[model samples]
Target: MKYLLRYQLINYLRTYKYVPPFSIFILIMVVNYTFVPNPILNSYSFTSIMLFFLMGWFTITLFHAEDEGQKIITILHSKGQSAYYGSLFIVCIAIGFCLSMVSVIYPILIGAFGEQPRVLHIIMGFLSHFSLAVLAIALSAIFTRELVKNRQNTWWGVLSILIIAVAIVTLKSVILPVKGLIWLFPPLHLALEMMSSDDSLKNIPYVFYWQFAWIVIYSMLLIGLYFFILHHKRKL
Candidate 1:
């Protein structure tokens, strides 16, 4: 298990497919803090959205990091589908964890906050960023090569879903009749919505409880469906 995880990590790094997403994240972080003394949660709200997109991009590249031949070889040597896919999932989540930490701590190091950031603010920033990262990964998982035969379409499919999911709040306001239908998408906006209110920040843990729980359940379903399809196709 340990070696398989390490193998996946090393393969991802050696491919350098991580470069663009990693570079873009750092570049945006610098730009995000260019105008100093930004409002804390507001600043966090914006970057968490950025992390959402980047994590989606990050997941795609990592998924394709190993070429078809190498992936087949890894699968043959591994214990089973569970170990292969499970290790990949863990590696992706681990990368998301690192990015989340950077998102929360970078602004503080640069002194970008309008006021002294409280412990609560720091916690919210990390949770928002990390939760979005996980959600993006789960959404992107179903759109990978196993199901999405066309490489180009897979990329656009993931992008379109992310855009629509994030834009649900706007869509709901514009299309009142189908608001219930629009709400079927993942509640990514809910993660950002609470952070927008000052009062919500006072009860950080309570405010995020449902949103966080929903994200967990939503992510698991998407990912489980993805694995089921991938496994079924491989068997066939």
Candidate 2:
């Protein structure tokens, strides 16, 4: 597993697949913090959402860094398909968390926020960034060559899922009657909304805990579905 992870990292770096999305994400942060005194939670809300899409894009790129032949070779050497997929996911998760830290911590370190951030604010910022980031990865994991078959369609499918999943909060508000249907998609918006709460350091919101639980369960389901499709539908 360690060797496989090393190989994935080397391959990902060699392909430079991480460049586009990561570069854009960094550029966005630079531009966003160019002028200081930004609102802490509001700034976090914007970056977390941006990180969601960028990380989804990064996941697709990272997962597909190895070509078909290389993946088959790696699969044969590894324990099984699960190990292979798991390593890819671990790598993506590691990358996501690293970037999440950058998004969450960079502004804080630079003191970009107009108001002094409390412990709750920092914790919520990191949590919001991480929850949405990993959800994006899980969402993108399914729409790959091993499952989606059509290369072009995989791009569109991943993009569509990310866009719709993030936008569902707005959609849910508009279509109040059918909001329950969002259980089918990742609840990324909830993470951003969680940050919007008017909670003080003395009192944390229950919704924060509830939404995190939902994100964890939802991400696990998506990952399970990805592996299930690989086991049942991938060519041997």
Candidate 3:
């Protein structure tokens, strides 16, 4: 597992430095800085949006890499699918945390010269953002397999729109007594709790459950794909 993590982390780090993803991340930060002044709100929304983008990039890049060369997949099969899948999931979560932290620090540093810093709140804010970002990434990974190919970004674009629509609907519907329905949409609830004034952390359990569900489903799908590829396709 450690070897698999190291291989994936190093491979992604090497490509991340050169890809348009970094430029896109910078542009996201710039937009947040220009418009979203409150660090608390900015961090949550910025991280959510950036995660959506990065998830798509990660999925496409992984597929493109696989299609272009067999070295990584060959190594993956050698190292064992369990380790490979675990490492991929861990690496994606780590990336989410790193990106959320970067976004959080930017506004905190700028606000330091004037505003009173609520360090605990800020930390919680980043945690919330990181949680949602990872959840979104997991969802994206599940939705972007060959079953739903990129097709000129059509898959991602549609998913993005659908996610926004569901969030909006869920946000409005959560006002009633149907709080149970909120668990179905992890990112929306996380973003709401982070942005709202409540600090009791009442929603953490639901977020964890939903995110865990996503991770389980994603891992299963990937594992199934690995086996299907090896057994039938003989080379994915």
Candidate 4:
């Protein structure tokens, strides 16, 4: 199992040879922060943009890697595919959390110099980031599988763009009472919660309840994917 994960890890790292897009994202974040006078707004905007880019590119790269190896269906036959997919998902979540930490801590360190930031806030930031990343990765995993399954769809590209755009817009509107249910989509809700200070809604309805719901849904989807590959292999 360890070797299987390492197999995927090594190949994934090699895929980093084409990392200029990520570098450009970091550059854009830095430029925005350097010019923006309002530190709080800058921090929020920077984190939001970075998360958006990360989720999109990470999804693209995962599917591209699988496609490059011509292993979409072949991977389903491997005894190690379950661990391989699960480990890849784990790695993506870790990368997302680490990136989120960088996004938050970078601004805090620069803007809060002398005014020590609270440890609790930092911890919550991580939890918020991890939960959202897990949610994003789960969706990406499912989407990649579907794309492979429906490779001939003429509108897949258009559908992909629309879905991502809707996700981003939905995330932005999460504070609206009726729209709060959109928070079930991890990254959107996390962004909404992180950007807002109004805890009055917490009394109205437990925020954690919705978050826990997403985590449950995401886990089940992952398990379903695993079973899918296993069942297909059995038939072969």
The residue-by-residue lDDT of candidate 2 on 121-199, one tens digit each, is 8888888888888898898888877778898998999999998886787777665567576676578767867777653
lDDT (C-alpha) at residue 24 in model 4? 66
lDDT, model 3, position 26: 75
Which should have the higher lDDT, number 1 or number 2?
A: 1
TM-score of 1: 0.93
Flag clash pairs in model 2: none
Per-model CA lDDT versus the true structure: 0.85, 0.84, 0.55, 0.54
C-alpha displacement of 187 in model 1, angstroms?
1.0
Candidate 2 accuracy as TM-score = 0.94
- Steric clash pairs (candidate 3): none
Give the distance in Å from residue 164's predicted Cα in candidate 1 to where it truly belongs: 1.0
lDDT of 4 by residue, 1-236 (tens): 56656666576678783276468657855775675344353255446545644655575465456553556554654464555566666666666767777766776766732334455445444545555555555555555553345543313642464266446655564445665554444344444455454322223235644653565475467547656865685578
- Counted clashes in each candidate structure: 0, 0, 0, 0
- lDDT, candidate 3, equals 0.55
Candidate 2 Cα misplacement greater than 4 A, ranges: 198-202, 234-236
Give TM per candidate. Answer: 0.93, 0.94, 0.66, 0.66
Whose TM-score is higher: candidate 2's or candidate 3's?
2
* Model 4 TM-score on a 0 to 1 scale: 0.66
Comparing 2 with 4 on TM-score, the higher-scoring candidate is 2
